[model samples]
Target: MSTVEPTATKRFSFMDILKAPLLIAIALIIALLLLGEYLSPGFASGQQILRLLIVAALMGIVAAGQNLVILGGREGIDLSVGGVVSLAAIIAGNLMGGENSGIVLAILGCLAAGAIVGAINGIGVTLLRIPPLVMTLGMLGVLQGLLVVIRNGIPSGRAAPGLSQFVTQPVFLGLPGIIWLWIVIGLAMAFLLGRTMLGYRIYAIGSNEQAAFMAGMPVKTTRILLFVLSGMFAAIAGICLLGYTGSSFANVGEQYMLPSIIAVVFGGTALSGGKGGYTGTMAGATLLTVLQSILTTVNIDESGRQMVFGATLLLLMLFYGRGKALRA
Candidate 1:
């Protein structure tokens, strides 16, 4: 009977769940929200939380593309996302020109603009063997210069009235339409990662490029497409931003550049790639949003907040880079 006893299969425990990044991020968000409430009586009210969530949604959308690039591996990082965001906003503002009729055209124009820049980055990284950091950093400078040139004595464009309303006004169940849009994007990303052949290919290349190529996967194309998608996602963020602010400026996107990366990393998407998902990123974005709000409540200035964020990011980089897996 003892000899006939079956060996046990390893089962995940509650302790493992406690160590999971997504769960940790959620816990942090709750803790920070409570801290905010303690500091400011109305800080954690449902309306305020909704507003913060909308902001998180914007960051998450941009991080989605970052997710794809990092997942495709090879030290992939997009420093030019800020630049792309600014550029796309300017382009979108111009195309939309304060009219609803132009919304469709603006979306297409922004996507095209973003795709071109992404394609260039992809070619540089894969074909020319330029490092992702160097390539995107250089592109960022180029994009900034282009922004300066394009804005030469010209003011940024305005959002259509309908567009602005969709982003800022409550549309369904006391939530703005943008939040609903975020929901849709999140679902789409989850499906893409879990159910699509391309998603599997992305993980394959990200995990081991050489192995993926040997296995007959189109590694180069996948990587390139990842960057393109990243750019397009940035473009979407820019468009939403224009609607949020009702107008665009040359420097509007610069603020979001670093935050986008931080959000992705915080969301528990591995910096080393091949081992994370969007669910963690959404949580991470919310965590950052809540933390920043709490800091603001504590009277920390913008610079102080930036310093905290930098330190937090540094710690996270080390943690995820070294920890590798969710283990007790």
Candidate 2:
């Protein structure tokens, strides 16, 4: 008899790797929609869903930046992102003053402010070897103080009318322009992380920094650029938020910090670094927004809602944590 040869099993494709979490997210979303419909017949209507997407878009934008930072490895994170958002909104609002003509300057100002903060963060982390957490936290305090001094603890400015109208006005398919903006931004981010040399270097450094350095990667430059990109993304999010709200405030970005981190982690990014993508973060953002809607519909008290949020986050962490261990 002829000897039988054993064939090697094929490794899973990238899409296959993504499908697990993506499917779970979709299922969870559907379940939530059903529950919402049961609790309130109109809860799952198209309009309601679109509203949820709008809110998700806001969080998604900020979370995208956090996602990038976390993906860069070496204890990377940006605690000051919330502060950046707040300052960006304030700057944009004041510069625009509800005037269409001021939109250009407003945008430039927001980006500049974000870039400056990001540069400082990059310098501190890459050059000084400061822990990212400590650096960003200190920066956060500084920004909070700066904003207070700038505004005298009183927020004073209206969002640009043109910007506000653009974000709020429904366009094709009954979706606001902001949603399209989110989609474009999401696509751009996906391309950046998956299709560019920069993306490859980011993952390489994240996976093993010493190895990446030995392989001739500009480790410091790449890390610093990651911070810069993160800051820019945060600024864009802040501007969109101001447009959505038609105004800006000192604490406007406060609620987003934790949510951004949660969304990034829940989307399956490893806290230790490396091995994740924007797709998971987007799904996480959607899930969070939907959960918020459910909590509101059920009239859950703030304390109860917080408890549920914490519990849910813990479960997600454990779930993904197990997956990570298994892969190891």
Candidate 3:
């Protein structure tokens, strides 16, 4: 009998880690589409899917920011994200006021404002020793108050005609400009998280703060950068909203708060932090947008839609909470 050589033992590859969330997202999208079609024969359409993609791109941008902060580890998170988005959208719109002439300055001012807010978050958590949850939650209140004072309960200004056109316009292969922007941001963020020393420090700090500090990492600077990154991304999401809606409303960013968290969770990013990437986040955003689109196509009322949204999030918690449980 010929002795059979022992088969080489297979080890888990990096590709396998990346594959799970993408597969899950695709499977869910397919299932949702079929279910939607069954419920409403007209529900599944290319146009509808494209629309969802645009929305997902916007949320994905926001989630990318949150992912950065959370990945810093140390139990970091940004509860103020909705407020930041809402406030930034209004501020950016007011600055631009649909004026082509003012667009450049407006963009600069909005980015600056976002950076300030992010810095505040970082300061509170790092210097004051405030927990991230409490600090960001406080920021949400402060920002909302600021937005309320700025608008005085009414959203003002239309997005610039040029900006609006660009947002909704198609680029190469007929994809929306927002989608292309997401691609650029995703590539940049992936590089920052994977290629740079900062990226290594983020994961290192997140995995174990004390260990990271011992290794000579600038923990404070890294933490601050994470919060600032969150603000920047949130502002970017707001910019997309401004373009998508053409006008700002007091509640323009109201729905995004929980959805942002849900997208990150759905992307397989643990709430407690330490492991995830923009790749999973992009998929998560797509899944969320598709879910919302499917519901709209089926003619779900506003209240019902909100109910479904909450329920879907709850289900995600149930399935994705395992990492949290394990960490605990």
List runs of model 2 lying over 4 Å from the truth. Answer: 1-18, 153-155, 323-328
Cα lDDT computed for each candidate against the true fold: 0.83, 0.83, 0.79
What tens-digit string does per-residue lDDT give for candidate 3 at 1-328? Answer: 1542111111223563455665677678788878887887756677766777788888898898889888887778888888888877887788888897766766787778888999999998998889999999999989988887899755587788777766787867888788888999988877777677787788778777887799899999999989998998888788778889988888577678778878888887767666777777888888888788777776768999889877986775575647434553
In the range 1-328, model 1's lDDT, one tens digit per residue, is: 2542110111133332343777878887888788789989999999999999888877888888988888778888998899998998888888889999999999999999999999999999999999998999999999999999989856788898888998888999999988998889887887787667887788777777887899899888888899999999999989988999888976888877878878888776677767677777888888888877777777777898879867866765564545646779
Which ten residues in a row are the worst by lDDT in model 3? 4-13
Better of 2 and 3 by lDDT: 2
Clashes of each: 1, 0, 2
Predicted candidate 2 versus true structure: per-residue lDDT over 98-179, tens digit per residue: 8889989988999989888998999999999999999999999999998898798445678877898778779777779889
* Each prediction's RMSD to truth: 5.5, 5.0, 5.8
Error of 1 at 45 (Å): 0.8
The whole-model C-alpha lDDT of candidate 3 against the native structure comes to: 0.79
Off by over 4 Å in 3: 1-17, 153-155, 300-304, 323-328
Among all windows of 10 consecutive residues in model 1, the one with the lowest summed lDDT is: 4-13
Instruction: Give residue 6's lDDT in candidate 1 (0 to 100).
Output: 15
